[model samples]
Structures are given as structure tokens and as C-alpha cells.
Target: MSSPSREAILASASRLFGDRGYRSVTVRDIASDAGVSAALVMKLFGSKEKLFAAAQPDERLLGELNVPREEIGAALAFRVLMRREREMQEPWAMLPFTVQDSPDPEATRAEAREKYLGHIAALIGDTTPNRRHAAVVVSLMIGFGEAVRTLGLFDDWDFDEVVAHYGALVQAQIDACPVA
Candidate 1:
């Protein structure tokens, strides 16, 4: 059989990592899951770390939102909830470890954190007043994603319910803040 293309490999890897944590999976496992040879996996992605980075959905999420300043909060919450639901359908919840055992894990995590903060800042529109609150809101969203995955909440709950819950909470925060 012809070797699977790099795109195919990356797609498989993304699903696998999103379903199963990156640490628990092996290249051979990914190859078997993708119906390709281990050699092909190695050739396509230099290492597991590189493969994880390549498979990450961060860029995709950003692209989906276009980083619109006004609608960023709702857009981010919607996208995050959608991603969580999608990931929950898989056999495992592939939550990327912000902190890896790499030499520069702190730097990597800091960059990721900053990316998230920037998105929130665009949404809230007041760096001084909303920066910390936005971070809290994002963190809460991440926690909610994990909880939904862990409890299989999406199996019974609908998207509207999820959106309503998050929307109300976010709006409450915005309303509480003094208008500048």
C-alpha cells in the first residue's frame, strides 16, 4: 500500500493526541492507528514532541475566530465548547499538557498562556480592568472543558445549554465591571 500522505498522518496524530494524551501514545501506536508504517511516522514528524506541536489545534482555533476584537469572547467560548464536544466523542480526551518535560517547557507554556490572554483581551477591551478577569474566565472555560470530557456531559447536554451557561457567566462578569 502507498504510504499515507503527511496530511493524513498529521490528521490521525491530531485525533489520537486529542483523544489520548500525548504522553500515553507512541509513534508505533499512531502508525497502527493510521494504518501506516512506523517508518513513515518518523519520516513525517521528527519526534513525538514535533508531532504534537504539528497536530495542535491552537492555530486552527485562532483561524476560526479571525481574532475579531468585539466578538472575541463569545467566539472563543463557542469554539472552545465545540472543540471539547468534538474531543469528547473520541475514545480519550486529548488535552495538551501546557507543561511538558522539555528543556523550555516554561517558555512554551508562557507563550501559550500569552496567546490565550491576548484573545481574552481582544474580547473584554480593557486591559487594566479585564485582563486578570479575562484570564480567570479562560481558565474557567478550560476547566469546564475538562469537566465535560471527564463526566461525558455532552452525551446528555446540548450545545445550547453549554452556551447559555458560559454566556450568562461571561455577561455577568462584563456587567460587573465599571464602564470606563
Candidate 2:
């Protein structure tokens, strides 16, 4: 089992990395934020690069890809909304930090983008027309997720209302593409 200090270091690393991108955060910063010694972090994660690998967004949430087509829209909307609610809930919060020209390694960014796209494709299934709609769904979810978390544009709306509206939007995208 991991020690509390280790968990704390990781949590701090995730938060810092998510906020500042990979190359910008330091082991010392994570150590200080976790109230631990820098040596401990180095000992635990070896190098800053390794620590970042550990801090990369957990993709297990994609397991929901098994949801039926009828439920995928709501499931995805709910998942994105929940991710916005807490940094630990979804790795989506760190997406902006891992984009092109960012400090994140190219492989890491490509892997993340591919994985998310795969999840969308799985949700939308194998239909040729649905493939394009899957891209739209991915874009909408990312835009809406960012808006709710970073833009404050939806601060006035109730949470359930937001989910409903967003879910409807997602469903509309899905509905627009008929399955062959």
C-alpha cells in the first residue's frame, strides 16, 4: 500500500501539473505543496518526468463506454460535469495543460487525445455517419466542460438543469447522425 505521504505528493503533483502544465512545475513545488521533503518525492517518483507520467489523467473513466447508445449522451454529460466538480473525479481538468506546444511530452498528448477519441468512437459505435458525430460530441463535451469549469458562464444555472441541457445537446448531435 502507498503511504499517506506518497498519496499526498501525487495529489499535489496532479493539482500543480493540472494547473501549470508539465515543464512549469517542479518537484520542490510539489513537495512544498504536499508538506513533504523534496527528496521524498524524488525517492518516490524517481524523476520529474516519471512523476508526471504518474500524474497523467486516469483513463479508467472511459469504462462507461459500454453504456448503450440511448444512454451515452447523458452518461457523457454527467461524466464531464462530475469531472468539473472535482479535480480528482476526472482528468479532463488537466486537458488544457497537455495540448500542442505545451510542456507535456508529445507522446503523452497524443495518447490522451487518441484515448478520448477512441472513447467517443466506441460510444457512437461503428456506423460511418456516426464517426463524424462522435467528433462533434467530443468537441461539445470538451467545450462545455471547460465552460463550466473555467468560464463561469453557467454559474447561474442549477446543476441538474445544466446536465439536462448539455445532455440534450449531446443527444442532438447523436440523433443528427443516423446509424447505417
Candidate 3:
């Protein structure tokens, strides 16, 4: 098992990176937040760049995609907007900041696009040859994520109402996709 200090460093880095962006955050800042020395952080993760890469949001969000095709929209909406229990410093919440400050923002963005459009597309079970519907749904979810995470939109609506409405819209896109 990993040592507790390592976990603390990782958690601290995740929150700091998300809050301050990669360029804005220093190794010393991470170490201070984690209650360790900067040298220790470097020893554990090697460098700031590697630490940032490791801190990117995990694939667990895709777990929501395990739902039935018809429910994919709601599942995605709930995952993106309402589900905030992961951690106080959830990496996903800082995605926008990381994308802006990462050393290779384009590459990071591309990786995310591939995961959301490719992996998620497959998980949605779009058996048809064309993936336009899946792509649209993925794009919509990205937008909703940005809105909720960065813009603070739609925070007032009843939870169920938002889920139902947003899910219905996304489901419309899925319904448009051709079946195998």
C-alpha cells in the first residue's frame, strides 16, 4: 500500500492544481499544503509536470456510463452536475483550470476528447456505424460540465427537475441514433 504522506501529497496536488492551475501552483505550495517538504513531493512524483499529469481526473466518471442506453443522458447529467461527493478537491472540478495551465494543454484536451468521445461513445452502446448521436451527447455533457463546474449555472433548480429536463434533452439525441 502507498504511504499516507504520498496520498496526502497527491490529494494536496490535486486540489492545488485544480484551484490554481499548473503554472500558478509551485511544488513548494503542494508540499506546504500536504504538510511535507517540497523535496519529498519531488521524490514521490519526480516533477511538477508528472504530478500534474497524475492529478488529472480519473476515469471513474465513466462508471456512470454503465447505465442503459436510454438512461445514459440522465446518468451523465447527474454525474457531471449533481454528483459532488467524490472529494472536497475533486480533480474534475478543476479541469478547466488544468487545461488552461498544463504544459501541453492541447494534448491534454485531446486525451480528454478521445476518452469522452471514444470510450464513452462505446460505453453508450451505439451499435450503429455512425457515432454522430453519441458525439453530440458527449459534447453536450462536456458543455454541461463546464457550465456547472466553471460558470456555476443551473445551481438553483430542483435536483430532480434538472436531471429530468437535461436527461430528456440528451436522451433525444440518443433516440435519434440509428440502431444496429
Candidate 4:
């Protein structure tokens, strides 16, 4: 099993990179947050760049699409919200900040657009490829995540209540989409 220090370094890297993006954070920053020395971080991960890559967020936000088409939005909402609690990072929720601060802004933006927004568009059945509705849904997703995780908007609220209400809102946006 990996040592607790290794896991701490990984979690610190994930949070710092997700919150501040790749360019803004340094090895010392991650090591400091993890309560370790920079040397140990380098020993474990090799380099800051490598550590960032290792800490990249999973693409599981839109994963596990076994639900009915009509219920996809709620499924997505539930997954993202739950992940915000269980996982250290929320790539979709943190995309804007990451993109804005990225050293290679164009590449970062393009990759995210293709992977996330494109997949979301497809999930919403925009086969005609139009994505206006899906974009709005993404906005709501980011907003909901920020409100809950960063701003603590739902900290005192019931988890089910927050997810259910937010899920329904996401579903409403999906339902508003023009059928392909």
C-alpha cells in the first residue's frame, strides 16, 4: 500500500492544481500543502509537471450513462455533486479557472471543449451538433459546483435536497433542448 504521505502529496497536488491551474502552482506549493519537503515530492513524482499529470481529474463526470435518456441530466448532476464531496477535484467545475491560468491557453481550452462540452452536447442528444442548450447546462453545472464546494451554498442543506433540486434544474435544461 502507498504511504499516507504519498496520498497526501497527491491530494494536495490535485486540490492546488484544480484550484489554481497548472502554471500558477509550484512543487514547493504542493509539498507545503501536503506537509512534506519539495525533495520528497520530487522523489515520489519526479517533477512538478509529472505530478500535475498524475493529479489530472478523471473524466467520470459523464461516465456510467446507463440511465434512460430522459434521466441523463439528473444522473450527471448527481454524479458531479457526489464527486465534489468524495473527490478532491472537480475538473468541470474548475475548468474556467484552469483554462484562464493555463500556460497553453488555446490547447487547454480546445481540449476541454472537445472532451467535456462535446461529450455533454452528445449526451443531450445534439446530434445535429448544435450545443446552445448543453452549454447552458454546463454553466449551471459549474455554478452549482462552485456554490456547493467553494462557496458552501449548500453546506447546511441536506445532500438529497440539494442534488434533487439541482438535478431537476439540469433535467429541465436538457428537456428544453431541441430534439435531434
Candidate 5:
């Protein structure tokens, strides 16, 4: 049989982590599922912690932020709102605890959080002025998304409606800020 490539191993790991929760899954589980040796998994990713980080979908959040500088707030809010909806519909939405339980959990979360804040800071042209406010806005969006998912509101509400509503609120907050 042909050996699985590193990409294939990572792909299996991503799905497994997304489906089973990171802590619940093991190297053997990923290895067996990927049709690769556990040693290969370790060799490629260093350790399970590293593997989980590598497999996280945080990049999807970053990817969605590739918008015009002038529209960063609206763009970021829209992207996060959209991601929240997508995550809710996917099995992985129920598995954030997996990422939260990582060895460097704070660092992992900070990295993801920074991605959002950095975009806003760049758009506003000042990391110091209203940075806390920007952080709060992003936090609200994330918290609301989690709440919606936890409450299973997506079953009745369309994802786009959620994004648009939240996006408009975020835009209003941005507009309310004193001209920088």
C-alpha cells in the first residue's frame, strides 16, 4: 500500500480533533486513521500538542480577514460572524474545549485573538487608541457566536442574518469612534 503523506496525516488529525475532541483523541487514533505509523506522526508534528495546533482552523479566521484596509472592522466582524455560523453547523463547533485544553492554551487563544485585534488596529491606524474597545468588540462577537451555538439558535436562524446583524452592530461601534 502507498504510504500516506504528511498532508494526509494532518488532514486526518484535523478531522479527528474536530470530531472527537483533541484530548479524547490519541496519536494511535490519528495514525491508525491516516494509515501511517505513530512514529511518522510524531516525526512530522513533533508532539500531539504541536499536531493539534497545526491542525487548528484558526487560519480560516485569518484567511477571511484578507479584505481592504478601510473595511477592516466590517470585514473582520463579517468574517468572524460567518465563521461562527460555519463552525456551528460543523461538528467541530462542539469541540472548542479541545483547543482550550492545550498545553499552551493561553498562548493559543492569544494568537487567535491577536489576529482579530491586529486587523482592527491596522484599520484604525493606531494600536493604542481604542485598542481595548476593539478587543471588546471582537470579544462580544465571539461570545455572542458561542452563545448562539450553545443555545442551538442556528437551527431556526439563517447564518447570514446573524452575520449581517452583528456586522452592522460592529460597524456602528466603529463609526461612533472619534475620527482618529
Candidate 6:
């Protein structure tokens, strides 16, 4: 069984990491935010790297994209919107931070590419490796998330209408993926 302090520490870690990326935030910061001690955080998570790894789960949300190709774009759109509503943020929003703000830019970029974007590209493609098209779809998702959640651009827009319109835009890119 987990104690409330442990859960609070974890929640603080996730929020700090999500906001400041990997390198900038530290155990002390997370501890302060969680109202715990640095020693406790170190004892619990071992290290900042371990804390980061634990903070970001395998992004099961991406699994929803594994639908039929024809419905993939819509699925991506709907899933991202759902995630924004539920999680207040998406992995794509952290891409730039995970790379540019990290100590090891190349490794971070490659890992994120493989873990998040690569999975997205593979799901969006049949057999041809549709990386370019997937990039645009991810870009759309990131932009939509930023606009709707951060800037409140589409507050009054009907949910279904936003889904259909953005889903169509994402679908156009999915349809452009060429088969090998």
C-alpha cells in the first residue's frame, strides 16, 4: 500500500517534470513542491532520471491510434482531445522540452522519436513508413492542444464539430501515406 506522502511526491514529480522538462527540475524542487524532503524523494525514486522515467508512463493513450487506417486520423484527433480534457497536457507538448532542454539532446530526441513519434508514424502507416505525414498529424495535435487548452481558442466550439473538422484534417495526412 502507498502512503499519501508517497503519492503526493509522485504527483509533484510528474507535474514538475511536465512543466520544466528533464534537466532543469531537481529532486529538491519536486520535494519542495510535494511538501516532502529531498532525502525522501531520493529514497523513493533513487534519482532524478528514475523519477522522470516513472513520471512518464508508456503513453497508453497512443494505443488508441492502432485502429483501422481509414479511421486512424479521426482516432488520433479524438484521442488527443480526450487526453487534453483528462490530463491537461499531452506528450507531444513535451517533445521540444525533452530534446532542446535536456542534457543529451540527440539521445533524448531519438528516444522521443522512437517512443512517441515513431509509434505514431508506424500506426499511421501501413508498410511504407509514413514519417512525414505523421509529423504533420502530430503537429496538428500539438497545435490543437495548445490552442484549445492553453489559449482557450475553441471554448465555444461544439465538441463534435471540432472533432470532425480536425479529424478530417488529420485524415487527409493519413490518406497521403504511401504504401511500399
Query: What TM-scores do the predictions have?
Result: 0.75, 0.86, 0.82, 0.83, 0.65, 0.82
Q: Runs in model 6 with CA error above 4 Å?
A: 1-3, 126-130
Pairs that collide in candidate 6 are none
Q: Rank the candidates by TM-score, best first.
A: 2, 4, 3, 6, 1, 5
Q: Candidate 1: where are CA atoms >4 Å away? A: 1-4, 63-74, 84-96, 100-103, 177-180
Predictions in order: lDDT: 0.62, 0.75, 0.75, 0.79, 0.63, 0.73
Top lDDT hit: 4
Best by TM-score: 2
Model 1 local distance difference test score: 0.62
For residues 1-180, what per-residue lDDT tens digits would candidate 4 score against the true structure?
A: 489999999899889887777878999999999999999999999887678767767777456577877887677767766886786577666777666766667887898777777877878876544588888888888787777667878878877787788889988988888788
Q: What is the Cα-based lDDT of residue 86 in candidate 4?
A: 82
Give the alpha carbon lDDT tens digit for every residue of 43-126 in model 5.
Answer: 888999889877766545444356554455556545645555464232224335544766777775676556767765555444
Give all candidate RMSDs, comma-separated.
4.3, 2.4, 2.7, 2.5, 4.7, 2.6
List residue ranges in candidate 3 displaced over 4 A.
86-100, 126-130
Candidate 2 error regions (>4 Å):
86-89, 101-104, 126-130
Better structure of 1 and 6 per lDDT: 6
Candidate 2 lDDT, 74-175, residue by residue in tens? 877787777766645345556766664254557766776677776776667636643688778778877876676667677798878877888888888887
- For 43-98, candidate 1 gives per-residue lDDT tens digits of 87888788877766645455444644434446555765776656522211233353
Q: Please, what are the lDDT tens digits per residue for candidate 6 over residues 30-56? A: 999999999998888888877776776
Poorest stretch of ten by lDDT in candidate 5: 87-96
TM-score of candidate 2 versus the correct structure, residues matched by position: 0.86
